[model samples]
Target: MIAGRMALGILVALEVAAGCRRGPAPAEPVKVIVTKNGWEPWKIPARKGEKLVLLVTRTTDETCATELVIPEAGVNVPLPLGKEVRIELTPERTGPLRFSCAMKMFQGVIEVR
Candidate 1:
C-alpha cells in the first residue's frame, strides 16, 4: 500500500509538469511536434506584436502536414521530414491565426491575446 501511494504521488507530479509545457510558462522557445498523427499541442498562445520563436519538428515522412502557413504574416514555410523548422513571427492583432499544411488537411491555430 505504501509503495502504491508513492507511485501515485510520482505520477501526479509528472502529470502536473506535462500540463504546464506551454502557455507562456517556460522560458524556452515554443515548440510543436509534428507527426503523421497531426500536430501535438495544436493551440499556441501568444501576445499581439510580441515576437514568438516557433520550433516545429516533423517526425514522420508520411504526414501531410509538410508545410506551415500563416496567411497574415505572408509565411509559407516547408517542413522537411525528420527536421526542425524554426519560424519567427510577431502577431499583429488579437485573434486566432490559423496555420495549416499545404493541402489544408491538417490545421492548428495561434491564439493571439
Candidate 2:
C-alpha cells in the first residue's frame, strides 16, 4: 500500500509539472480576401514575433491573383484565383512590409509594430 501511494504521489507531481509546462500557444490565423483590385485590408498591423497566418482567398475571376512580395523576408508568393493560400509571417523587425500583385497595380502593406 505504501509503495502504491508513493507511486501515486510521483505521478501526481509529474502531472502537475506537465501542466505547468506550456508550449507555444497556437497562432491565430488572419483571414484576408484578395481581389483583382487589391487586398481587402490595405494595411494590416501585427506585433513583432507574433505569428501571422494570412489566409488569402481570391475573389476575382480575372487572371490576376494577389502576389506578395516581401523584400525584407525575400519571399515572393503568388496567390491563385478562386483559391486560398496560407502565408506565414513572423516579422523579426518592426516596420512596414509591402505586398503587391504580379502587375504591381494592386498593393498592400503589413505593418509590424
Candidate 3:
C-alpha cells in the first residue's frame, strides 16, 4: 500500500508539472507578396508541429501563379489579384514543403525544422 501511494503521488506530480509547462509560442503571421516574379521570400522557415500562418497577397495579374498549391498538405487555393489570403498549416515533419502554382511553374519552399 505504501508503494502504491508513492506511485500515485509521482503520477500526480508529473501531471501537475505537465500542466504548468507551455508549448511553443504562437508564430507571427508571415506576409508573402506575389508579384510577376512569383512568391516573394520564396524560402520560408517553420517549426515542425507548430501552427504557421501566412498572409498571401498577389499584386500582379501577369504572373501564372494565380493559385497556390501545397500537395503534401492537400492545399489548393486561388489567389485573387490584390487581395490577401490567409493560409494556416502545421508542418508534421521536418523537411522541405513545396508550394507551387497551379501549373507547377512557379515554386517556393517552406523549410521546416
Candidate 4:
C-alpha cells in the first residue's frame, strides 16, 4: 500500500508540473469606439514585442473618421458603419504610433512601452 501511494503521488506531481508549462497567455483586444470627435480612448497603451489587437467599431456617421490609417505600420482599413473591425499588430519598437483618418482630420496614438 505504501509503494502504491508513492507512485500515485509521483504521477500527480508530474501532471501538475506539465500543466504549469503553458505558453504566454493571449493579450486582450482593445475595444476602440469611433465617435464624431474621433477614436474614444484615443491614447491606447501597448507593450513592445507583444501582439496588439484592436476591435474598432464606428458608432457615428457625423465624423470623417470612416477609415483607419496607420502610416508607420502600413495599415489602411475602411471602417464600416456600425460594425466591428479587427486589426492586429505586433509592435516591435517602443514609442508613439499614429493612426488617423484618410483625410488626416482625426488622429490618435498607440503608446508602446
User: In terms of TM-score, how similar is model 4 to the real structure?
Assistant: 0.78
Which pairs, if any, clash in model 4?
none
Q: Backbone clash tally for model 3?
A: 0
Query: TM-scores of the models, in the given order?
Result: 0.73, 0.69, 0.78, 0.78
- Per residue, candidate 1 scores C-alpha lDDT tens digits across 1-113 of 45643432211111122353445443356889987778887899987756667889989878788888765565678888878777876666688878888877888898989
Candidate 3 lDDT tens digits, 32-54: 99999998989999988787777
lDDT of 3: 0.78
Cα-based lDDT at residue 90, candidate 3: 72
TM-score of 2: 0.69
Task: Tell me which of candidates 1 and 2 scores higher on TM-score.
Answer: 1
Instruction: Please report, as a residue range, the 10-residue window in candidate 1 with the lowest summed lDDT.
Output: 8-17
Summarize candidate 4's per-residue lDDT along 1-113 as a digit string, tens digits: 45643432211111122235446764898999999879998999988767677889999999899998876776788899999988877677788878999998899999989
lDDT of each: 0.71, 0.64, 0.78, 0.78
List where candidate 3 sits over 4 angstroms from the true fold.
1-24
TM-score of 1: 0.73
How many clashes (backbone N, Cα, C below 3 Å) per candidate? 0, 0, 0, 0
